[model samples]
Target chain A: MKAIALKLCSVTGMKWGIPFVKLFSGEEVLEQLKEIWGTVGIPLIAIVTFLLIWHFGAKQIDTSLGQVPGPAMVWEQTKALWAEHVDERIKADEFYARQDARNAAKLAKNPNANIRVVDYTGKPTYIDQIFTSLKTVFMGFLIASLIALPIGIICGLSKKIMQALNPMIQVFKPVSPLAWLPIVTMIVSAVYVTNDGWLEKSFIISAITVSLCSLWATLINTALGVSSVNEDYINVAKVLQLSPTKKTFKIVLPATLPLIFTGLRISLGVGWMVLIAAEMLAQNPGLGKFVWDEFQNGSSQSLARIMVAVFTVGIIGFILDRIMVELQKLVSFDKKTIA
Target chain B: MALLELHNVSKGFGEGKYRTEVLKNINLSMEEGEFLAIVGFTGSGKTTLIKMISGLLSPDEGEILFRGNPVTGTSHERGVVFQNYSLLPWFTVYENVALAVNERYPDWTKETKDIHTRKYIEMVNLTPALNKRPAELSGGMRQRVSVARALAMNPEMLLMDEPLSALDALTRGTLQQEIINIWTKDKRTALLITNDVDEGILMADRIIPLTTGPNATLGPEFRIDIERPRDKTELNDNEEYKKTRNDIIEYLMDMGAEVKTKKTTNYRLPELKPIMPGKTFRKRKEEDKLKYF
Candidate 1:
């Protein structure tokens, strides 16, 4: 205030020496912070600085190669996605009826009084699409784990089994999910038949493909984890003459749980990522198809709309991982010894 | 027949490209209900000796007999307490002990198993922490829980590998007294692997010093003539205790220093100093002559 007073009131005449009060307080700023924060003052400062940097960082990002859109565009895209979803709700029943012969004609034609002007594009609601994708991922993830955990445990416990499986595991593990898609599609298409034959058996195909691709990482990592359990613990188990089933349930499983959980988390992450890509390529009704269609449209805000899906994916992946970590901590009561 | 016997025992590790001998010509016999302490320099095959006795590791050249029956792999008849606390951390103290009880006495009901587990838990003075996991327990407390776990199975021969080395001095002494009390109460056969001379004097009827590896063998056995329930604090007044402790210490110090000097010599070192192909040889005979002489 005094420096401003000297500059504006005294015509820059004591500007240097006029801020004695301000300087005295300024010198104590760090001291005050130290008193308030004790040890965390520096980290607090760093966090504030980082937030400032992030808020002004939009212009620096190059959006040419599918980088995340800025916050303003992302928010607008969310509204646009909502509008698209609303448009899709108007004609969904009619489109399914035209493709397959299973629709109630009156409901398809009327769709109640909820009918609106933009009703031709004909899509499922965004909520429905999200639910559909979530259902597939959960199903795939469950089956993958159900198969992988036992097989992985068997490989871990027996040297003979491990030796036989090692080559097959190595060969199949590196094979991409994209590569396996055709084979999986053919299998499900051949194996799973419907009562009405309405939607053409796409549901099971996508889920199975997702599972086959995602589960290898879990199985391999878990087997390795089980194999690495301390030899002394095995000795402990043997000396006690624990039955094989009891040994597996009690000693082996608990000892190898952290590793199994780690594999599960990784497999889950892969499943989520691959589902989006699989849905896009496989023409499955999911967030991927929605995002993929928007991208191909190339509207003025197409990129922005796709940005919303991208953000959702990232946030969903992060939340999924967090869920698994919390689950792991809950199940594994083993206090891991610090090596 | 002795309760446990090592007949001309010898052991080694690896084969072909990296073969190395660990134990050489170990012959010993233990009657039932005897407590023995084997004191040796670090890496003197004391752990290997214990492992061979427990059948965790097999001796390459001899038969380890439990009352004239050749030892195979691990069996509940001989229980081992490892150097580090290997209590399954997921289980509470009671659960950890109960694992062994459940395994050992599968025919018993859950109530009987609970009673069996709690009996040993109380024996180790860990009844209060029966529901506490290893992470929440202190080092000595964890060790006590391990002892409880081992004792719960009621193995005929108890094997301890420096079970108190990680504890503080006071805690070690406290547990030392507790272990002695347990041993005397049951009079089960026990073999303790320790480098502590005072511990050897306090706990064991006989102490054996092992020479340094890779040709390490049992050197000498000292019979502690001191009375039972030996007090670590007041052992200085006994003249025999003084002589035995000093003799073992002096013997172990020499063996320990020999290992330190001999470890750096790296008998496998090759090529760094321009060695010829012919010089790369297994000089076992020469090394043996140099070491044993």
Candidate 2:
């Protein structure tokens, strides 16, 4: 049962739970304690120390809004944000219920009347903004991956193609999301003229900008990875008389997948970061927009709320990175320890 | 008819002043079911010869024929066991073997492929390590998997590039015996490239010396007329084994001396030293018929 528990923890990526499982199972008590202290206790202590420092620092510092938000203020703002989210959800539910009743009455009054249930277009809550940001970043990341992987493979396979792409990659790689924003905005506004489309114009602009900025990392890394695939494996593929497509998919792709995942992880992180900046600058509906709005409002609570948003952005980024790493581990057959 | 033949093959790398010729006017032919070993110095283009026959490389000049057809590109007909084991590190021993078996016998049922893969894995005595990846296996075991992978392809011919050179002595000896046992069971045309003279004698029917490079060519052939299933310990005292070993070593040493003398003379005639073809340990007789400058 203890062995099963340990296995379950490992599979779930809850490796920190192993110590507790072992301790409960009457394994070496001291060893389990050491493992727990190294993995969990150390991190908890560090967090507490950081919070103490922030509390002390908050008293000394003064901002234009008021004081720098301490741990307590940030915690309070976090609770307030959660309450706002709940209140918004309740209001949406009530609005939908009222709409349904009104629609039924309209239908009863006139049998052939158009009785449409309109959507609740309330101001998005903090939770809703978080989801918006996640969606935008994912859309951008997906587009980047779709475009970059094939191009990278082509560049890797042919030296001439790589040479042709070299100058373009060099020129575009360092261009910031801020630099891409104006061009992306102009093109999206000019081309995407449809109102009430599946995606908002602002969302499309931000996503395209994110994709443009983030694709370089994946493209370069993927090219490097594909080129570095073992020559012996290629020779084996040749010896087997595998077709071109089979060789690429079966031998080349699998061999370079670990590095490709590394590239993807970087691209996702870059996309997320670029999305936040794009949202702030473009006034798109996301956490970045929320932060900007609160700052412009300049209330006492505004500083604490912005602090909450800051912590939220950090935690979400950490989670996104962890997800990519987990996915990489699942796909890579070479199970070497990764940092 | 020869199963594989190389005719006046010449290969070089680099350009102009940096150009180094690795093989020149290399002529060789092998029949079906014959085990031929080419022993050479470290950089003597033995691998180039093997690659030429395997069709991974094409000679800059001359033609390589496989059963009278010109060899153009790599084919499953010639299976290669590279000096480095070349097993995909991600794949298990069983998967590595099964990959080749499936490729070669695509029409075979999954069950048949599995059984075929297992047969060769068992032949290499790696049944216990079937599920283990290459990284988990020792050097010898990894090489065994490579050997198994190649054999599972069921190719018409086998090309081994010093396959046991990376192994320790005991493992090398054990694998050598395993190879001989497999060869005896299925008499496939085989070419082995090695620097180890004893290995060549122990495993091959005829051992040919590959001269030191900047244009290496095959020297005189030494036929090993020793009986089948020859024991190494017993052969240590055998007069025939000792004499043949000494003769081959003497020729290689002479070639080494020739290389030292070659540095002073920028352009010189290549020696046409020839020895008796079969079952003789006599010294090489300088044949005047062949000449190259």
Candidate 3:
């Protein structure tokens, strides 16, 4: 039973369930009971208490858009958003079916004619905006990692390189995504000109802004990781006469991986945050844009809808962090320190 | 020709006024298949000497030659067993040994490599902990793994830098026996740098003392004429063992005192006017009394 619990904890993100399993198995009942309470019961109770406060406190607050949304109002808006997504998906399916049918008829009439089916260019729902935000953040994070890791390694390996790059890193590290947004928008607009391209100009601008803002964390962390490699390991490599490339991959990379992953996690988080702000300011299609659009809408339902987006963003951010934690656990050799 | 030779090797750290000479005019050599031990105090340049032989460090004054060739940089020809074990924390014992074996014998078959890796691991008696990472192992066990890794490389020479110092007495004794047994079976040209006088006598064909630094150098060599399979229990009764141990200890003690005297006497106040020694002493005493009054 313990074995099963351990396996379950590792294979899935159900480590919180281990205490319950132990309690059921009658192993140190009092301690396990406390663990269960701490892991599960306490969080549930706190969430319930928060909802109660929000439900009551929402009644006293009033804005130009009417009362602030209570728990029920936000839930209603969440349901409405989900329902709108489902309705849009159904309309998209019909549009595709109609296009396919028309394309078939055209091909039947004249085999040589162009029968291209147009995409369903409908209004994106809340779910679509969430997906767009995720895609943009990941793209930016990937780009940031690719550029930062090599430069970081080189900087770590050589003091001369680090000295040369130090000024640039210091100058650019603290710049806000908002500051980058204008320059990125201008560059992307000037460079990415096409009526129907693989990616939109707004997306390229937002992604570039996210990369500019987020790359510093990864760069700094990776350099630190590389610099902090063990002297003994370096000696081992020297004695073994390991080629430079092999030394980096075999000894240096493994030694510094924990710090590198730490940098990546922070970079991913920074990228996610920067992406949202960029989307909102650029009026791009994402959760941030959805919130901005609702804020400008100025209806009674707008506040509730925006509240729904707020919860969505918080939950998604938490999930993204958890994913990075899991990745870190997989890569890190020092397991005792991770938790 | 000697397996390794160092000719008037000197090394120092820092530059100009801040410079501190750690090793000075140190000349030493080891014969092929001969075990040599260097005993010294902490900060006595023993580690620096070992690094020089291993080609991890370059001498400022002279060159080190291995098999008549001038040693340039670190090479697979010399395998080192470091004091701290230096195992990758992520790798298991088998993997750690295998990493070196793979590097040293890259063209060997997989089966041959695995067998070779296992043979040395078995030599160190770490088969039970073969799957365990360094973090999981005790200090003694980690050292054993390092020993196994160095041996598995099949290098022409083995260099150990205080490898048993971190272990407790019991583990250290056991590892010493294991090292002797391994050396007896295959006589690799080996050099051990240790601070322990007893360990040096027990392990090496000859034990050399290193003077304390600000410019440290080898003092004298004491050849251990003890027979093979030297028993720890009977070592107390052996006259030669006692004599070697006492001679090394006495030399180290005298070296310590000599360094202290040298430090005080070597300070030359050349700018001050020379005076009669007794007169100056009286004058300083009178000056002290006047200041107090």
Candidates in order have lDDT scores of: 0.79, 0.88, 0.88
lDDT of 2 by residue, A247-272 (tens): 88878988998989999999999998
Off by over 4 Å in 3: A1-17, A36-57, A91-121, B15-19, B106-115, B127-132, B254-293
Fnat of all models, as shown: 0.71, 0.74, 0.90
Model 2 residue runs over 4 Å out of place are A1-46, A97-116, B16-18, B90-95, B101-133, B136-138, B168-171, B213-215, B250-293
- Candidate 1 regions exceeding 4 Å error are A1-71, A83-122, A197-200, A296-298, A333-339, B254-293
Q: Highest TM-score among the candidates is held by which one?
A: 3
Candidates, DockQ: 0.49, 0.54, 0.63
The 10 consecutive residues of candidate 1 chain A with the worst lDDT sum are: A9-18
lDDT of 2 at A240: 79
Candidate 2 lDDT score relative to the true structure: 0.88
TM-score of chain A of each: 0.69, 0.95, 0.92
Give a tens-digit lDDT track for model 1, residues B1-293. Answer: 68988878999899897987889999888889999988765677888888888877888998999978899988888888988878887788888888888778889998988888888999999888888988899999999988988898899999999998888889999999999999999899999998776787899999988887887888888999888768776787889898997787778667766775787785766668655654545456445433322
Candidate 1 CA-lDDT value = 0.79
Please state the CAPRI-style docking class of candidate 3.
Answer: medium
